[model samples]
Target: MEKIRLGKTGMMVTRLGFGGIPIQRLTEAEAVKVVQRCLDLGVNYIDTANGYTTSEERIGKAVKGRRHDVYIATKTFPGDAEMVEKNLELSLKRLDTDYIDLYQFHSVNDMDTLNRILDPENGLYRIFEKAKKAGKIRHIGITSHQMDAAKAEVKTGKFETIMFPFNFITSEPAKELLPLCREHDMGFIVMKPLAGGMLDNATLCFKYLLQFPDVVSIPGIEKIQEIDEIAAIYEGPHNITSAERKEMKRMTDELGTRFCRRCEYCQPCAQGIPISLIMTFPSFVKRLPPDWYLKGGFIPEAMEKAAECTECGECEEKCPFNLPIREMIKESYSLYEQVKAANTK
Candidate 1:
């Protein structure tokens, strides 16, 4: 496995790292097995978050005595100094680590949040600096769902790494973000490398991302097969043919531009629906069949059907892209129900 330096964070990580989000779906034993497999395959970078349920605890259990084999990075979702400190403390305790390799400011969406985090008095920088001085964290980075906010952070020349969504579908903004990271000599970690399991062609997507210099794509893994597949991608020469590129463009166009970017901005559903996961059912079902939803028999029962919508419009009001999210959810629910009905019938 080849390693790339994570920007100015002064840590080198494998081109293929283990993402912590999807691990939440796995049992403790399963999660540990997959994470250890990642280490065995030379994947040294692992990212997790305090907000991701029990992901941190799983990583702590997985690494156990072999913590030195991987570079651990986790995010703090603290809004203010007090919360930031507490979040870090909890994350460190959960991960059973004394020092974090890279501590990121998690998912800043707009300039107001950015300004608040950058502020010295009541903001994140104070706590971040305090933590760094205390030797609890070695370097600072930022992750964002918005391209504009990520670009803004890169220009500041303060952060060592910048994580954002990047896939064959959203390669346009990535073209800009990629070069900017290189110019600043910052590590670019790509989340949603598969576009939330929408894009079926993982080989092409991973190959396309590798064309950019100094990028590390961490595909979320739960099953051992996923871990092995990603390991193959890292070990293989990630190159795309001209024909594949043409086909990729055609497929993405057909998939439409409104695919869930996995921004996680459409959260805290008033209905407690796990709206993001539910809304993305179609994409995942199409790409990765025999998924958890299917095995658990939740799709046909637990999901909210499109026709059941009461038009509360809460999701629409919060969407930043002004997406026709209500209509999309309606469309997704209907489509999913139809598929399930057909399969069973």
Candidate 2:
């Protein structure tokens, strides 16, 4: 595995880091096994979030005796200083570690939220500074789905790293954010590298991302097979073949019209629908087995929520990718309803 310096934080992380989201769906033992496989394959950067249910605990158990061998990064949703402090302490406890390698403000979406978080009096940045000073966390970072917000945060030079979505489908980061990170010597972490599983060719995705030396893509993994597949990429040629380029174009064209990147900009629906999840459920249905889908929490609850979407157009307005969210919700609901009925039968 290839290693690169993670900006000013100074942690040398693997190009292919382990994302802990999918592990939430795995049994503790299963999650541990997958994480161990990642380590065995020389993957050293592990990222999870407090909001990811059991991911932090599973990673904690997985890295118990060998914490020094791996770098752990976890995040908390933006909040007041007290909430941020509380979550940081909880994350330390959950990870069974004295200090976190990198702690992030999770999913910061807008300028207003960013302003509030950077405020000196009650901001989470102060909490993170205090934590770093007290040795609870070594570095502070931020993850955002909004490119504008991420760019602004990067320009401030306050964060050690900035994580955002980057893939064949979403390449806007390449134009500005990528160069900005390099300019500032900030670590650039790529999330949703596979475009939330809408992009079927993992090899092509990895090849595309590997072309950029400064950015690290953390694709969520659950199975040992996923670990093996991703790890094997390091052994072969990293070049994107012409055939692969054609395939990438085909996939991009097919998915460009309707795919939801799960940026969560279209949130707080007036009808109380999880618009991003509902738009994304169809991809999960296609990628996962029926049993895993049932056990993995993609139940009819998503459909029930989708049914509540009143075609209010708020989600569409906020969507940066300009997805037809209302129409996508209808299609996803139809698919979920069919799956629900089949399972009941």
Candidate 3:
């Protein structure tokens, strides 16, 4: 219902945009319905990615006749110029569009990766510049979970926007990165506004983020009900009431210790365990039905993968949040086993 300027791209996007990740799990027809519902509710910014299996295609199909009604943004993993070029073509094809409104280099976590993408000889930035000049994309943006990478990109003044995790629990971005974006006139897009679904109250989540006027949050939307819930917030009060703030404080305090934001920096576990997935199981157990967790790929085979962790501490070194990932994995595995046993009974 309300619009904000998307940095120097000069595109006015809705504060509550459509995040395309969850739509990948839905059937094409189902995904289309959800996306159309978003547009029907006047949500005009659609953020998807080349990495998200069929997200781009589904958004493309849903917005076929209504392309002009939305600003389409999508991303690809960082790579050399040639690889980026290839991915760009694939995204264009999948979206069935001539040009994307915003194109981002996805998940750049550190300065080294940022340098690689910005390198002139073989870097992806050059290709993105060319694409912009050729009208293949309207603007270039970058997304990352790491604050260091985000700060570095903002200093370079290369990207028109920066997408980062921003919620009550993860407030690091608000301190410096957000101020930098404001100073640079760069659009600040808030990803993971609900903290990877750890924060269940969508109304409070939206209220918390709306405090920062410049930031646009794209929470993952897969169901019309989610759209309805978010839309209700748009029509309601804009400011966070004192009571609401108190409730937020309580929720954050409760979740402060054990919650995993799923930044995925603690990746490539030595035992070949998916640390993010394993750590996320506990939250799923709390919020979702056991059958939903199992059918959603939290099967025994996957849960048992956590048992392979050697507790070597390598993942902890890389974890920015300093979570006790080792113990968390153990606890998550135990919960998974208990849930599985109970479900079988």
**lDDT scores of the candidates, listed in order:** 0.79, 0.86, 0.87
TM-score of 1: 0.81
- Count backbone overlaps in model 1: 2
Worst 10 residues of 2 by lDDT: 291-300
Query: Where does the lowest 10-residue lDDT sum fall in candidate 1?
Result: 286-295
**Candidate 1 residue-wise lDDT, 6-72, digit = tens:** 8788787888888888777777888889888888888899999887777899999999998888899
Off by over 4 Å in 2: 262-277, 283-305, 308-322, 335-345
Residue 302's lDDT within candidate 2 is 63
Candidate with the larger lDDT of 2 and 3: 3
Better of 2 and 3 by TM-score: 2
Q: List the residue pairs that clash in candidate 1.
A: 7-186, 7-187
Off by over 4 Å in 1: 260-326, 332-345
TM-score of each candidate?
0.81, 0.88, 0.85
Residues 61-161, model 2: lDDT tens digits: 99989999999999999876777778988999999999999999998878898999888787778888988999889999999987778899999899999
Candidate 3: global Cα-lDDT? Answer: 0.87
CA RMSD for every model? Answer: 5.6, 3.4, 4.1
